[model samples]
Target: MSDPSAAGPTIDPMDTSAGNRFAPYSPENHSAPLWIVSILGLIYTIGVLSIRLFIKRRVFGWDDSLIVAGTLTGLVQAIVFFKALKSGLGQVPEHVPNLSTTASLAFTAQILLLIALYLAKCSGILLLRRLFVRDQQNTGRLCDVVLGFTVVCGIATVVMSSAGCPSTGSFTTHCSSTNTRWSVVTALDIATEVILLLLPAYLVWQLQMKTSYKLRVIAAFCFRILVIIFSIFHLIARIKYADTQPSPFNIVTTLVWHQTLLAWGLISATIPNLKAFLQSLSASWGGADWGYTVKAYGNGTFEMKSMGTQSRSHAMASTTGTENATDMDQKYETQIQTRQVGERSSLGSGGSQDMIIRKETVWTVVRS
Candidate 1:
């Protein structure tokens, strides 16, 4: 259903006799990776968002809202990808339902994918701002610059891609200038990933946290490196495997790699911010009962010192493996304790009374 004047000549999808021919071997299905990665990533993203909203314990913000939108867009993008696969992607063109249809669907998916990725990155940046750049003026300003730059690059890609190709024409074949545009977009994408990676690594060291604790936090944000890798691979696939015309074999691998990146991108964005909720999962980050000693100390309350006093007194204390909760707060003390989805108590006690101490609290959530 392409505008033949703009897209040029086309053939029926099922008319393999008129379709482009590929390798002689039997075609393999690449949709498995696409399906696995897209579905699972969406499930994880939605599951965490549900906890943030319905459970109502976790603080919600702009980042969470962005993730919700991104997830919806991603779902639509995935469906388009599947439709492309059904049309002819990753198979012998002759065997597919329609090469022209596949091309159109893929173009649509490409647009949606860009939107999904843009939203996810924005969400991550917002979360990063809240975590490290909230109070620091310079760092916060730099974070704003990054966010603005991302917005520009996203718009640039959308404009270039929208003008580059249509449903029926061959892209990356005769469109050398369009390829150059994509090269620019790809470079910006990689730079964005690198910046994201460095943000946490650079800023975590600036915190009053101990070196070891800072490294752990940096490690939690390491998925950005993989995102960079996927970005490069996605560019390569787009530039290398394509034909002068639409072909299923060439597009399938690109789809697979793109899905891989998106899945990991979700992980990269969510894991760092979800640390609080993650620690409570009992399955994440060295689960409970790792031979750590605890005395069960918590007042489970946030209260003020007095009606006339302008100061607040905290009642919860954080303990390491064996550190006592009664001690005053230390500058570099790492909080090592179990956390759960609904704020489950780390220590179970029947006869002992609840002890109250003040512990620093950070309200954070996940996004993808």
Candidate 2:
């Protein structure tokens, strides 16, 4: 890597001297940055749609809120990075018209990226808590442990990022510390994602659902593995440029990988909540409702009717009662008894039994 400072004092853009010439911006230099911005925008749009579906179900929780917050921060970082590119961040130092402005934008963009990454990780942790922790009392313990660990990691990342480039006076002066900081942050990020992925695998395995259903659910949540893959790529890019002085290609590569990491992080966090939307779309296309309907009768009996194309019905007498004889049928008085039949199966050898009993009561009173 060439010493950036040894290249000489900053050159003014307006200087017409032959030695002070700067390369003109072209499509080659701008394409990567524009592509990164467009990708970020698309990911943000999808994340927003997923979150909207989640909210429409009236199941919005802390995890969803954290994801939204992280996304906003990521948007800010993207804008700042775009500005840095416009200000000559990915251009050769000699071609960079205003080095000071570019350095400032780059520093601000990194700080925002660190904060956004932390928030996204925390969002994933909160999501795991909501999915796996059923007991309210035990929720605090597991959530606190994960939250504290994430907070510590976040603080360490911010501190290191800030310490890496304490002053924006010169970009190359901080290369060594910046390299170490990014490597640490990347490792911690991969660790947190692994923890998030493992936390739910055990719970999913313990579910009483069919094996295929369990595998499907596990696969949906396992999308975080993509985020981990992106993080690895980002780490590799950082390492590749560890010894090189900041240049147009190096800066663009780092920015691209960084955006990719954040994009996948947001996507993974939002994917699970999209199941309801996907189911709705499938139902719309298939023109079938896949659920059971329960109807109660005046005789203290109820029937479970399958609503879809594969229709089946089950009727069980919940209670028996005799009405008191009266002058008029409408004037008769009766006391309806309610009883819950536990684990009743349909009247067939291979009928599937209801593993859980649903208790409901219906009463009619008449006076004349």
Off by over 4 Å in 1: 1-25, 28-57, 171-174, 243-245, 283-368
| TM-score of every model versus the real structure | 0.66, 0.67
Error of 2 at 240 (Å): 1.6
Tens digits of lDDT, candidate 2, 231-280: 88888887777667665545667667777777777767777555446554
The local distance difference test score of model 1 is 0.61
Candidate 2 Cα deviation (angstroms), residue 100: 1.6
Roughly what TM-score does model 2 have, to 2 decimal places?
0.67
Query: What would the per-residue lDDT of candidate 1 be over residues 64-107, giving only the tens digit for each residue?
Result: 67877877788898888777765656665656666677777878
Q: How far is 140's C-alpha from truth in model 2 (Å)?
A: 5.0
**Candidate 1, residue 4: how far the Cα is off, in Å:** 53
